[model samples]
Target: MTRDDPRHDVAAVVAALVAEASDGQITAAGALAEPDSLALLGLTSLGQVRLIQAVERRFGIAVEPDDDLVALDTVESLARYLRERGVA
Candidate 1:
């Protein structure tokens, strides 16, 4: 992961968000790496809101209420979405 790679940065950010949301219970060791790991994050509705807010603050991106939240269902997808949105 380099400063020149937005996807890597996005992945790092997503990992951080997942870590924060999980209170470090989840790590970047494939805990949230795959779509199947989404449930392991144990995000509630409020946790989701907090994660969104953290992402917006950390990456300077706005996540509208109508945005397809499913894109964040997995770490890779969230990283891709952030990269597409220029969040790197």
Candidate 2:
């Protein structure tokens, strides 16, 4: 992760948003890169919605209700997703 890498910044923001949405249940130091991190972070239905909303607002992107959330399963993937959407 470097300042020159958009993914680095995107990943950090995503992690921060997830942490906030989880009420600290999910943290940057809690191995947010694992594929199962999303499964564990979103312990509740409301949590999932909140996480999506937070990220959407921050990046001005929308995660349609029909979108496959697996793309956001990990920080890296979410960062890539954001980059693909022209976030950087």
On lDDT, the leading prediction is 2
TM-score of each: 0.76, 0.76
Worst 10 residues of 2 by lDDT: 28-37
5 Cα displacement, candidate 2 (Å): 11
Per-residue lDDT of model 1, residues 3-84, tens digit only: 7775456677687787787677667655445566466566666666777788889888898879887776777777777888
User: Ten residues in a row with the worst lDDT in model 1?
Assistant: 28-37
The collision pairs in model 2 are none
Q: Write the per-residue lDDT of candidate 2 for residues 28-69, one digit (tens) a residue.
A: 646356666576655466766787899899889898768667
